[model samples]
Target: MPAGTGGSENYTVGQVRELNRQGVPAQVVTVGLDADDGRSEFNDIPFRSLATLSEVGGLDGTIVFVNEPHTVPTKQLSYLILHNPPPIRDEQKAFAVRGTRNRALIVTSRYAAALWARYLDVDVSTINVVYPFAEPCFAEQPRPDTSAGTTRVLFAGRLSPEKGVYTLLETLHIDIIEQDVALTFTATTAGADKPQGKIIERLLGAHPGISVVTSRKTPATMAALMADHDVVVMPSNSQYWHETFGIVSVEAQHSGCRVIASDDGGLPETDCGGVVLVEPDNAEALAWGIRAAVASGPLSRAARQDAAARFTVKQSVNALLNVFAQPAPIPPATIIRQLEEQVLAPSAKVATTSRPDNVLIETAV
Candidate 1:
């Protein structure tokens, strides 16, 4: 389960849906209190209340899957952790305590897993790397004309500080205003505070050419917005709130828009040969990247098609199922010895009664 919307929600929803399509029993549980009318289909899949997940019984031997380990109550069960963001030091401590107790940890990228292993002091054996996949919506569609006159640049996400909106504004100032290029900045505000909205308004006010579209766009609307644009720019910084896996980048690529994204977090994973990665937080670098993307001309229909094929929901589902099907670690010999001496003898009778008779027992004596 995840905290809220973004790449985590999108990945979970799409992966679970695809797993169901493949006849694999999969479900998504989210702690989102705000009622979203459309998420009902997935909400129907055995949603245990986030508040009550710890107290709710009967989860033994069941693989509890979690996207963000810090958000969920991991003390309850062994989890397949999906590490995405750059974890805070305290978050790492929490994960370290929980991960050593859980069954296994799975990360979306090797880079993330390596970081966790290094910082959390966990054995590398416990962590697994599984790359995320884009939904079918990102499959290659027809490309629009890129004839250099007026290019539309779309940025579909929250207008928050971590997204580098200020940096994006600076990049726009350099590229559009200073360079005298006709470019449209299409942005949608998802979940930002009043102050952030005010800052965005001020930025937009400074540049009349930059159009700020603020309304909740559905999947179709988002796709349409992508299709309407000639290029997609993601100038996210390496801050805690950076993009993980860059789902919007994939969508833009599928819509046949050249993608220029920041080289941070899981963005490199989304490069997919179609995206151009630029230095994070460098406005000059971003401006140059955007200019190069525009000069590089429209992506060939074949390149976009290849990118779409590379990142499909089916592939993501298959990877997750493969991880799930893999045999969990047998209790370590030292752990077995310790449990046998301390836990098994005293609790065996109670455990035998509560657990199945067929449950295997390793005696200490």
Candidate 2:
């Protein structure tokens, strides 16, 4: 069940769509979002809600793929997908408490699993790492050699501080100007149209050659963009948002662009020999990486081959099904007790002490 928009939700939808296309009888069950129950369509996959799951004969034999393990229900078989390490202190507790309810924990990379194991204090052996699959369109496309003179650099994702958009801009301003380069910044909204958004607009406006594309691009569009660029920079900051898996990095590599990513979270894991890893939150390091990437020229055949070998939809689907096939280890009674004691306990004081007028506290028996 997908719970929010981003890479995780996109992965969920992609997996379900692929599974259904492969005649696996898979469908999406959206959680924490308003969707009608039974036989709805989203992203071309059949969707059903938690309430109408049984009506579709899902309850007889089913596994809930929970994207975020917050207030997890332990009655049914479940697999928790831990994409990123808990982003905040409260989420750490929630992940730890609710993670135990799952039969298996899935992660996109080994680094992600390790982070989860360390953060949740769970056995390392219990977590499963299923690398995300890039769509077929993301494969290498024949493009012109962009290695000489000016390098075309592309930055894709949210235009927020957490995404290191500002840091990238700073790098371009300070160091990258010496090197002839073309930079493009694309996102849904410029930092939700905040002051930083104004800063981005000004930066782009002042830099006459720099380009900005404003739209939410699909995978095909992103792949097209990657195919044209010489380098793709994903310089996310760990303190702000630890990137779970650099799916876009993989896409770039597959599309024949050299990737320069931060060595925070799972970007290193996703770098299958074609990526240059740099320290996060450092403009100097990022600039160094960009220069290094440009010097190295376009991705070599060997590097491209290795990068494409890292993940595939077939491999990911097999891994997911394997996890679903396994039975849960913990009893339902134990999970309920853990939820009441560990999950709800921390929130109890807050619930009683002070709650906003808009907030309503509800308990399930």
Candidate 3:
């Protein structure tokens, strides 16, 4: 599987893993990514490589494409999962949307479906929701002890402005805390290798009383990290980024930790009985939110139990299978072609769909 260090990577790998467990076949086909490109994370999931997404247009059977929409429409059944919000400019995203037509468009949350619908000028129902699940490893994590009068707060998101690392930086000083926020703050180097990540890490280094560590590479590792903490913060920036669905927010709750996230976007929906919503992009609000989480003490056993029933791989995969079972709507072009083939003589022309570099296909279950 491609070595992505964010929620998108976790969701893709987690879905593939669960799909196999449920006897539904799924394989990760990467464009511009190799089998051993960077890290061996999510190595259990099967992976295939293609030079460009266009090569998969002729791929038969049900193909589920994630993130980037393919420029070429699939010859058979397909689905596009819009993990990120649409681009600001209409022209920038319109081409990509129109280029890959007739596939059922999927979004992570109702908020995301509406956001994309408003941008693309389509009905909200046209975009479907398939919420990402917290992999079993997260819930399997042992809850941390928080009765020691100190709440261990962890910022598990990528150290970038959109993820709200900068806002966090301005929120945690003594002036803001003033003994009210009695917590040991820590930040992860999730995207520290990237240009923006490097700058954020440097800024964190200059700050005081903040512990820094390398990003957890796997769900098990990330779960372990969350289990060691009492609370997880997701102060997502609303100005530059509207979080489609904060998967990490649910994951943290599954780990038996309270989630302090922005009130906007789909973040509010990520609550599994332990999320505390605060104003987005406000340092003071985040600081107060942290203080509130600290004052509330440890998450109760009752509150922690809702994650399994509400969000799980079984539910997510079954919902997807149901979506796939629905008959695909035929477009006008497809009907026209069918009519022409009935009256025409023996077909001589063969449609070509291939790239210079061949795409590797693999089967999974």
Candidate 4:
């Protein structure tokens, strides 16, 4: 499902683990460029490479759900889950082609389903909307009395520009905001080869007083930490990878923390109540949202109840099963021609089903 151990991959493993618990024969086939195959266990399920699975014919009749179609096989019952808002024209063309080759297309938000349907040049009915879920570990925590002063704000997930880390830093720098609030940043992108991580590092270096919590925590640990915070900020920018299904915001809401997130991508669709939406990449708006959350107090019992009722692993898994039960529709002749002309042109790198390296695993970051 995921190429590496990121948010999407982590969520996939959790869902698969739940599926396996409920008597579903779900196994993880991690598709990456790493060579020298080695076996590992994730969420008590067998984690194998695509190469190893193909050698044993394990892919036969398996419904492969992928976000990155570039690196995965277009085999039996492939469900392409659209996540990234790609900016590159060539990448968009390639992604559109790769998506159509799949048997079914899956999207988390209605916004994504509509955007992708237009981008892929398909009817809106063709795409299925199945919302993402937070693991059961993210339960509500006891809220601190806001009247006592010192509001705690958190920004979790990848330290990338698309995640609005830069915007959060700028908001913190503004002098007009209340000084009673303390901010914290967690999660490290030590292995990710992204410029956002470097930018976050420089920002942290400049503002040493901003707390740095330990990164790379287990689900329970992350949930516990989230429960301690009063407000969680997710100010994802639309310039590059906008906040697609803001998982951290969902987790925070479920954990009894008020959420202040950018109204970009699938973020607005997470209207489960108690979310304070703001404009993306705007420091003033983000600051206002944070301040408003501090004054509003903790999430109401109804909001927390709504989160529990709607955003559960069981609901997501059952929807996925429904999607898998249906038969795949055939691609149109016009779509086939577009794929042949644009995606497989002389300038484009030809894709092959035989090679596992060419198979991309979309992380949906």
Candidate 5:
């Protein structure tokens, strides 16, 4: 279900659309607020929403695929697709157990699958790695700007603490700006409903070279935005909430922009022909890397074409279909035992706090 507009939501929607295109019966079931107003963006695929899994029928022998870990009663044929393994908590452990007991578990990256499997101490065979597709944003006309002037760098994501917004700003303050590079920070502030947003806003307010742009731009517009930039920097912290596959990095490569992403999580997996990798949360390293990327010549035409070929929607669908075709099953006793353990274990409490710095900023250039 598309609960919000993030990597998982985008990946889910894209996979569903591709599957439907391949003549597979797939439907999107959404939970939480409808980010797209319940619009069927996919041409032929159908979508529905329900508060709980019990509301739906014919779950028996049906491969119930879930993006996140949650309790969903299903028949023998079911699978769990995890974009990221939940943090260390009793609920997360229970979710792992449920995932291991399913017919198969699909993960976006090997790193994520390994994390889940290690946490649960289960066989890694149960997990299948299926990288998400990068939405193509090829510029209609190449905007080659090799003037040896201030390099323009773009970063797109939520301005959350886990996302390393503060780290990115700090890197600019210590590195990019110091090197006379222009920084463009674009994000969907809706997800940054935390104190971290205030920190990012303050950083933006103080930095003249840094512009925070926010809006749900269409694919074409996004491609134009990427084409205008020389490089894309993804300086994310290696927290539980880090990038899984980093669709933006692939998109940047597709847009003919050099990508400098953190080595943490799945950033290294988006190897767009030796994509630059920097350490997480290290402003100095990020700064040095940004300077090098800015100084380097524009991405070769071959790199962009290769990225487009590697991360197409059709490839993503085929990878998922291969996972679905696998004949993996977990015994029922293990599921019941895990459920019993969950009931016996103390409930893990999680506290969420919201902050007012979540407002979207529209930069007037």
Candidate 6:
């Protein structure tokens, strides 16, 4: 709930709020997350920490686990929001696949559904895709005037190698880019406490064009920050990490910032107009993309309106509620296995209506 938090976790905070606002009562049930901790907005959202995750087995309700898979079995039907890509290690992958058992899996994008279907050997349709929506602030904030001489560029992702922060460093060091006085660079201190983050921040903060600022604490502030910049860069490293869906890409686009992102994973599925995709992990191509964005100039009013309509919280929340109203679409093989083991309930359902009761969201890291 604070700056530098992972996308999935940040997603949890917003989703729960929207769920509650829609009359679908939801509360965060945490495991070892201290509500008193000022490091995050845990105190802001409605959450209660259990002594252990095993306690989740004793609770009654439709359990909706976020990001990570739940470790314990539950009495009521549970749903898992499979946020990250499958683990690379065979053992980890096997464990993750096992965690999906007896749980309806909901991923964020079509690309994620395909990736997980291949990993789990299930039909892609069985894994639902409730595409993430940009917060209202991103779409509502008026785009800043770029008439100011410098073209502002921002790196909004976490300051880690996987996010291509180091690659961005390489791009900035290029002779042509380094000397281009028209371009001004900025980076958020997302993950600045990590070893790699500290190293990157030090290197970037020392640069003549870059300024490393603390990441915003809220979506409104983040939208304001993005609005000030003419371009947003997301060079996600495709070497191992495959982004299921690039929320930052959508947020930036909604904020009317021309995005220069790597064309990998679900980034292409971001679907918002006005993005300039480049080769993943290539500094030269990213630099070229920045130049391309600068050449294109600011987005028109019509383009901003289209982006605002394309990805809204209302659509996402409606889709999510629809998923809740229906039964979990378990594959035939999984259903057979569960039936044989007497684990499949005869009338298994995620929830009863658009606004279900007893919703508990697990914010497991």
Q: Which candidate is the best by TM-score?
A: 6
lDDT tens readout by residue for model 2, 108-162: 8888777776866666677778889877777756666654466788777556667
Whole-model lDDT values for every prediction: 0.64, 0.68, 0.80, 0.68, 0.67, 0.82
Tens-place lDDT per residue, model 6, 45-70, is: 67767778899899887788886776
What ranges in model 1 sit over 4 Å off? Answer: 1-4, 31-51, 56-61, 70-77, 89-92, 140-148, 175-177, 193-207, 215-217, 239-243, 330-365
lDDT against true structure, model 2? 0.68
Error of 1 at 11 (Å): 0.7
Q: How high a TM-score does candidate 6 get?
A: 0.88
Each candidate structure's TM-score, on Cα atoms with residue i matched to residue i, is 0.77, 0.77, 0.86, 0.80, 0.79, 0.88
The residue-level lDDT of candidate 6 at 15 comes to: 79
Off by over 4 Å in 4: 1-5, 32-43, 52-58, 71-75, 140-147, 178-195, 332-365
Off by over 4 Å in 2: 1-5, 31-43, 50-60, 72-75, 91-96, 99-103, 144-148, 176-209, 331-365
Q: In candidate 3, which residue pairs clash?
A: none
Query: Runs in model 3 with CA error above 4 Å?
Result: 1-4, 37-39, 144-147, 178-181, 330-365
Distance from true location, Cα of 162 in model 2, Å: 2.1
Residue-level lDDT of model 3, residues 222-279, one tens digit each, is 8899989998999999997899999999889988899899999999999898889999
Q: lDDT winner among the candidates? A: 6
TM-score rank order: 6, 3, 4, 5, 1, 2
* Better model by TM-score: candidate 2 vs candidate 4: 4
lDDT of prediction 6: 0.82
How far does residue 309 in candidate 4 sit from its true spot (Å)?
1.7
lDDT of 1: 0.64
Better of 4 and 5 by TM-score: 4
TM-score of 5: 0.79
Clashes of each: 0, 0, 0, 5, 0, 0
